[model samples]
Target: MAKVKHESRWYPLESGESVLDGLLRQGVSVPHSCRAGACQSCLMKAVGGAVPQAAQVGLKETLVAQGYFLACTCRPPEGTELEVAGAEALRVPARISSLSFLAPDVLRVRLVTDAPFDYRAGQYVSLVREDGLARSYSLASLPREDALELHVRVIPGGAMSGWLAAEAPLDQRVFLQGPAGSCFYVAGRPDQPLLLAGTGTGLAPLYGIVRDALEAGHTGPIWLFHGARTPAGLYLRDELRQLADRHPQLRYRPGVLAGGTRDIAEGPLDALIRAECPKPVGWRAWLCGDPQLVLSLRKKLFLAGLSLKDLHADSFLPSTPQVGASPAAAGAR
Candidate 1:
């Protein structure tokens, strides 16, 4: 017999259970979405212990060489102690119950999975379409229910978005790999403040954070800074307003980037985030948006005194084509 300790509770088993299942049973929060390990959402560090090279984790050769293994596929080898944290990961899988237009160019997609999808507020999923097309989207679903909602921003020459907008069926079977990134709310650390920066379709994940905070009863001050090229670029404004109305702890500021004459306002995002929460000393931040915005905010927040560990983010992306889909874009420099 072997002892499996997780989340402070030990589950003694004749055979070790899958690493993720054991962790969840013990209440240890490890970021994961696509349990199949295709999304790399379950990336975790093994403090001490070794896994068989041919065993189930399906880790890449490079990652295995670095001692990186998948917790979703972990099986203990007698007397194994595990230590995992919320790092760069998130994901969830659900069906499109409905898709509506929030703006002419922005989409509001509602999804509900057959299984219970557990994810932090700021996490997101990769929406997959027929013909091997994929789109990265953040969950707008509130913590109040199991249904997942996502805000989608279509880009020109994108296959997934066009199919989702015009051809994808409501009941069609599409696969998703997520609750996949490190972007999310941290309620346990309520002693520190929280800053949420959103741009364009980025409101999807931010909305999730606000709902989770309200539900978890985090009393700390929350500053939300959202930016868009025009008011039209701001998806779910009405929903955000409703969220603000419901929670006194949440304060939201909407900024339009196009209206700028003063030298101070380089962009709407820069103005809103810098003006309100100028310092990130003890606060935790969740940022989701265009890659440029995500990268810039991470840099700026660090400069403002926030430790690298304190900042979490997910860079939004458009539909990626597989078979007739366009090639993957180059990694940002």
Candidate 2:
């Protein structure tokens, strides 16, 4: 049996069990998705073990050199010990510049990093408070916009959300880590049709991506679907409408759960999206928001002839006290 140590806990790895399986069997919660090793979400470093050779497959050379390995695919040889990668090495200083509501429950948060941070439009950064509580939020502002912007939907009773909405002091300082995830607009695909869909504050990342695509001079059709529970939840309505009107190739569609007298569709957003394009062949797609919604739409897009390589997603999982997916239960791919 391999002896695996994660944090302060130790587990006896059963024969043929991967490190992740062992950790999970011991009741350790590790944030992970696409456990097949493709997403790189369960990345952990080998502190004092012989990491399996296969664990480094497809990883960047720098990461490999730094002793990083995917816990999902690695099985330690007998007598190996390991630990979760330390996050302190990745955090940088940031300060909240402004906080204002986009809706009754959602706040538009703008922060300025102590140093310039370069990231793609659809990536997310994890914000850490002094108490060590942290949550990820997608960047809604573009790189050229000169600020780090996020749309934070205040969850009732949520620790981070409650403080930020009601109790946070002005110019509060925090630490940020990552411009992480794989969902963003890539350069040189100017003619490829792009599809962006999300529910609630999930629109945050999509909003940035739309502007990035337009700024890149993409000439193909760009479709956006922002889902909400009601008309009042449809934040940024006029702004998105004006944006669409200014760009002939952009189409903005807001979806509502309960039917109402508006230009938006009623029902689940994915159903409305399918009604818009029954066949999504050759189109690149990005999905954020609810985990079930992202997973469901991902499958539908694949069955509609979209390749997995062309579909990117970020499904927000509920945050644990020490770690989290995102503030609004949404993340960027």
Best-fitting candidate, scored by TM-score: 2
Lowest lDDT 10-mer window, candidate 2?
322-331
Q: In angstroms, how far off is 210's CA in candidate 1? A: 1.4
**Model 1 weakest 10-residue run by lDDT:** 324-333
Local accuracy of candidate 1 as per-residue lDDT tens digits, 14-112: 465767666655555554434444445455555445654433244445555656666656676776654433223222345789889988877777888
Query: What lDDT does the true structure give each of the candidates?
Result: 0.64, 0.80
lDDT tens readout by residue for model 2, 198-269: 987888899999999999999999999999898788899999999999999999999999865669789988
The best candidate in terms of lDDT: 2
How well does candidate 1 match the true structure in TM-score terms? 0.67
How far residue 316's Cα lies from its native spot in candidate 2, in Å, is 1.4
